[model samples]
Target: MTSAPDMTGRTLLQVIPKLKGGGAERTTLEVGAAFVRAGGTSLVVSSGGGMVEELEQGGSEHIAMPVESKNPLLLAQNARDLADLVKERGVNIIHARSRAPAWSAFFAARRTGTPFVTTYHGTYGAKTAIKRRYNSVMVRGDAVIANSAFTAQHVRKQYEGLPYFDGSRMVTIPRGADLERFDPASVGEERIRPFSLRFGEGFKVVMPGRFTGWKGQGVLIEAARLFREERPDVPLRVLMAGRMDEKPDYVDGLRRRIAEAGLQGVVELMPATDDVPALLAASDVVVSASTDPEAFGRVAIEASAMGKPVIATAHGGSLETVLDGETGYLVPPGDAEALAKALGKLHALGAEGRRAMGERGTQHAGQKFTIEAMTTSTLLVYERLLGQKG
Candidate 1:
């Protein structure tokens, strides 16, 4: 919590669309909390969600506002509102996390003469010119922070015309998980036992992501069917754990497929929960079968940190997080047969091999994905930005 060298009393204003229970929102909370702990005032402005309580718990200030509005009139009003908030709070820097809020925060910071910083959380699909312009705010940060090297590459690719986006200025600060929360010791074995019981005494494959099609739920289901066909005695169960963030109809379709495939006993759908660590703890193999690449697979890193082998699609952050053949395996995206083959290889590994894989993964995660490392790199960004502003 101590101030990084050269950062003492500057106030930072973090602007996010909302404090949702996701990686981007969690990062905002952690960075703001770190700032506060470092003897600097940190204030967050967002529409607000479940993590608002966590922000407060960390002794940071939060203001509720509809920062996600894209309507021109609403955006103008948001700019004024943000300007007032910045001035009133004596904010020295404005850190925007999403495009919607970045628009308002950009102008507000400009009006207030405050430094504007942004994080490229993912590749925002921009099919239209207008959308592309909106998405450009992420790269427009006086200091842009990318969650992964993949994200940084995407940013550079997206802004190829803008020659000013020096790769050095666009920092890659990997997301960090609370090691204590994700540690095997922190989660209760008793709590995880029921989950194991639910899957029966067999190999458990867990995919924790929203129920959206892009998350590759269908791919996972197909893999499960293939696995079952090859080894009926494997007792393989696929745990689909994530909230239905969008497209409820898709979720319905997924359930119907499970039923039609006669996978009632083999597939279970669970809602999002705070006990993600425990769920990961209980899972024998964690799979991130995202069809579309993720910016940074926080779940993959967390599972690895907990000494759990992960089988993720060989794309996006998964490529960085999972040490294929050692920590886990990575099959081609949407390749159900390949995924099935990887699963079979993992299943074939006896307890000792699995344990060794898990140990290597844990060691890698601890070395590369520590909270301290993330915090330090982030603080360095802040220090450099403040220096430029000063």
Candidate 2:
């Protein structure tokens, strides 16, 4: 990252609904620490979660509040509270990472005359006018940062005719993989050994994400079943790891499918893990089978960075990150047959061929999707807005 911009007395207060294990939450902490390292006071406003301690340890203060509430009354109340906090703590800029919190942060910035910034983290579905208006808060920021080029384009298309919408204010900044943790050189056998034993020497493939309907964990299970049918001679093991508690019914559905398809031992639904990079390192290949488009699929790039061949759905951010026939293969969204076919193709490549593809993917992620690059780009946006305010 270029020279840390001089942010000596400035303060960056990032507001989000929760301090949790998601892309937005992770980015919130990463950017806060970068702000601190650049000689600024960094504060986060959220309902505390497991990551709060980590945030504090990195020199960012965490303020517990009800910013996650979507109730109209609570939004106004949160805005008042945030405005007061901004004045009390001398918060230079308020960056919101979610819709509900963005509403509060927007008014707080207005009330306190502090620069308001936002990151568009999801492709919010807006089937009605009310929903569209509700989603509009993100674009209202003095600067709106989209996590991927696909997201930037979507935002521009969706919000172009809005009265105050200025496309220039939006920028594309991809979510980054934490290289320090994901570095292959740093991950020793001790870390990989446990997972290695559990999944065994079979061609281990892992899909790590929240076990939601749209995440397509079921699709992956189906693909695994089909792959076993097609390549019965080959040993196939699939690990679908995520927070199954959030969607018990869906998880049950996946479990039933795995059992009925006779993929009980071949496919396993493990709990969410903190050490995803190690899981990627332990596996022969990684998979991103999201039926819906990912705003920015961090897992695909993270797997690539770990020298594992990735097979991701050929849509959204995956298109930009995964180079078909090079870094990884991209299959049609929700097409189990195509996904299974891609897996077979990877197996055909043999060990050395897969390694070469993974090497290219590592280079691709190292050059483009990196933690330092993401943090540095974000700091630039903050400093630019601060410069404007002066």
Candidate 3:
């Protein structure tokens, strides 16, 4: 790994669409805090959202802008504005997290001769040439950061022969959890009590992600039904927790499926919570049923960090993060039958056996996926890029 340079007194600017509760936004904040700790000025440019205050409190300045605009004219204007900011702030590096803002940031960095960096946080759709071109901005960074080895491979295969593509420039830096916060010992019974009461005293299965089709809420619901049908005597409940408002129709469809399956009480759709670690502490098992590939599965890592067993699809970043049958289980994507069988295996483990699995997961997560490790790797990328420029 490249070493982190002395970033003291340097200015680093990160651009994202909004300071919301997504992995990208969280990573931006984590890196920004690291920048502050290294005695650098950290600035984040976003439309501003729930995490803005948190960003500011962590010694990072928030610059509100229309960087989210997809309008061509607005994007061009944003480029000019960002160029101005780059020059004025003497920004040493411009790191972009989202595609729309990355386009603007790319141009601004080029105009000012500032080092440009981008994190490919998602597996963006590029069925069309125009869409591919738009998505390519993420890889245009002087140093393109891939959140996982899976994501890095995806980028390489997707844009293999492009003139701008450079395999050596792609860096894999996985997303991480705050181990201190996610530690089971740190989360008290008080934090887990309310969720435990709501979920009731049974084997609790949790799938934490936004309410989207790709998240496989429907699959989990079906799996719950199948599991119940196979073992009618087994006490179990499935909790689907995430921001359901983004996709009301999807949520409605899921609720309808749950009702049709006679799983009204067995499957619950709850809003996304601020206390994911607490919920993980309360859960017997954590699930990531993403039908689509995740660039990096943060939920799986978080569950592992919390000393909870995870059951995720055997694809995407989950393949990289999960140790099949060791830390957790992995079934085929969207296979409710396979998922139910996996769940059965976990249930057969009993409390003590499952606790042993969780302990192994916790140890693995602490070594591989801590926020400190992620931030340090990121800073090394920044330092290397800036050092080359200097």
Q: Write the per-residue lDDT of candidate 1 for residues 262-364, one digit (tens) a residue.
A: 8998998888767888888887899999989999989889999889898999999888999999999999999999999999999899767887899999999
What would the TM-score be for candidate 2 when compared with the true structure? Answer: 0.98
What TM-score, computed on C-alpha atoms, does each candidate reach? 0.96, 0.98, 0.98
Span of ten consecutive residues with least summed lDDT in model 1: 1-10
Q: Which consecutive 10 residues in model 2 have the weakest lDDT in total?
A: 1-10
Give the best candidate by lDDT: 3
| Each model's lDDT | 0.86, 0.91, 0.91
Task: Rank the candidate models, highest lDDT first.
Answer: 3, 2, 1
Better of 1 and 2 by TM-score: 2
Tens digit of per-residue lDDT, candidate 3, span 215-303: 99999999999999999998888899999889899999999999999998899999999999998888899999999998898999999
Off by over 4 Å in 2: none
Backbone clash count for every predicted candidate, in the order shown: 0, 0, 1
